[model samples]
Target: MAATARDIAAELRERIKSGALAPGKRLPGEPALVQEYGVAKETARRALTMLVTEGLAVRRKGSGTYVREFQPIKRVANRRLAPEGWGSGQSIWSADLNTRPMEVTKLRVDVESAPDNIALALNLTDGARTLVRDRVYVVEGEPVQSATSYLPADLVRGSAIEQEDTGPGGVYARLEELGAKPVRFVEEVRARMPAPDEVERLHIAEGTPVVEIFRTAFTDEGTPVEVNRMLLDASAYVMEYHVTS
Candidate 1:
């Protein structure tokens, strides 16, 4: 009886968790695993692949698999969305970053016809136009999330929200300046296998899933002001929400 890939992967997982294999350290390659476990090369490869698929390891082309080095970001939903955080010239994202630096890349702002769901979320009629802002969020040079925000074009057309850089508290602040300040939010979240573009954009491993979030922001009058769709690398985030009754 020979050890299966799962057996080897399990052992390796424990070793990684126990810090025997430090982050960025290469794991035993196929040949080494083959000899150590007395298993076929395919079995050894599958073992390594399992670790990669689980997000515990990464395969480097022309190199060997290494323990994943990127630290997971803690996303605090309630704190980040609280108006107090963003209303006083502070960015809502600051709650999540602490001292860590997160960069926005590939930012694009355009006016387009809203998608059906987005239009509905914003209480717009069919084919309503929106100001679409799209960007990728990167930490330590690794892309961890992508987001697209849709705001009613007529409402934001002349506002700072139409710019690539929404100053100070970001879009919410701009909306407030325009008398459409967001006072409440609702978020819907789901996990699913990554689409091809998401895999490329987030640099996610095969078999890795993504978390999709749709957040709708409304003003005190309960009029929807913005709809934001975010796709997050599941391996790169630990979502936290504060709840109260």
Candidate 2:
């Protein structure tokens, strides 16, 4: 008896999850798959398409299909917390944002042009040069979040701010080190469909939604110092915000 598409897809998915087929590794071509699975070309194609829709594989325009790396999605609750005064109260700096107590595996800094939306949020002139920091927040030796933070190059370049690598701290701590204390932050939250790249990077299933957070941090004098956009997989994590009034 011939195996169904679902059966074939399930076998492939198991292989992917079991590490038999590593991420970023290319799967056998359709002709090879057809021969191996004893299926027709159409059946093999359908199986491959199913993998793509499930966020397990990505097909580039000309490049062959590759297994998409699985990135865990974490949920953080959004709540208003008691405002901490300067040099008072426990801060997020004291708590590890890595959640699973994982070490920083990768840190990348690049000079990049700002997207229109980022430019508007940061009040930058169009086509401005921004220092972008890409970090993968890992937990228990696995990637949980992939973050890309943008800043005015003039504010962080050639400073110790870029030197520190790992600790129980965040970008806010680095800003404080630079004498720019962030006193308050305003966050805007929404949900949207994940882009193709996001779908692949996050390893989210089809029809799954993502939470989008836009955060604007302010200095002690109420000047906007930083704007950050965070995308989270809704199924794996939730945002928690505590408020005291």
Candidate 3:
């Protein structure tokens, strides 16, 4: 019997898993695969496509298919949301990332009506506009996540939260100063295929999915202070939550 494309793909998958095919190393081009595997062009193409769909390889336009360089960042729920992490003076990101670099590639502040879901979470009445803070987070020069925060327009009208930097500890710190500090948080996470815009913004490879996180911040009095929606590249993060009894 002839060696099927599945056989070729299985062999290549093992090579990638065993580190024989290092990240960034180009894979065999279609012609090369056909010649080496003695398979038809269609079979060779299917083999390569299989690898890509499995996230083991990435296809680049004008370049070629190569092993993926996936450096997954950990998103630790407890540590990142602790008061000491962002309420004091440290950035929440400091709780999870090591010495690797992370930056905000884009920042946009505006006043807009909250989306239906966001409005419900923030307890905003109909037609009420909120102050929106949107930012794109990059790690190691690669786009990883984008977050948009919604705060009551009246509550943060003149505060530094309206500014680009949001000061040392960010919005959480400002909320503290306003006597509406975030005392509790609820977060929900969901995953699905990336949207067209999300793929372009994050520069994600084809067949990669995205994780969506919705978080609501509340004051001790049970008043919701902020609602945040975050979209993350699934290939670049490990989401973890610690529960205490």
Q: What is the TM-score of each candidate against the true structure?
A: 0.96, 0.57, 0.89
In the range 29-69, model 2's lDDT, one tens digit per residue, is: 78888888899989987888888766678676677778976
Shift in Å, residue 22, candidate 3: 1.8
Model 2 backbone overlap count: 14
* Candidate 3: clashing pairs of residues: none
Q: Indicate the worst ten consecutive residues by lDDT in candidate 3.
A: 49-58
The stretch of ten residues in a row with the least summed lDDT in candidate 1 is 91-100
Q: lDDT tens string, model 3, 1-245?
A: 66688888898899998999999899998899889888899998888888876667878888888997866688899989899878678888988786778899788999998888878888989988999999899988789899999999989989999999888898999999999999899988999998898899888777778999889999999999999999988877888888889
Ranked candidates (TM-score, high to low): 1, 3, 2
Report the Cα lDDT for residue 241, model 2: 61
**TM-score: model 1 vs. ground truth:** 0.96
Q: What would the per-residue lDDT of candidate 1 be over residues 165-221, giving only the tens digit for each residue?
A: 889999999999999989889999999999898899889998889999999999999
**If ranked by lDDT, best first, what sequence of candidates would result?**
1, 3, 2
lDDT of each: 0.92, 0.67, 0.88
lDDT of 2 at 219: 83
Q: How close is candidate 3 to the true structure, as a TM-score?
A: 0.89
- Measured with C-alpha atoms, the lDDT of residue 109 in candidate 3 is 97
State in Å the error of residue 84, model 1.
2.6
lDDT of 3 at 85: 76
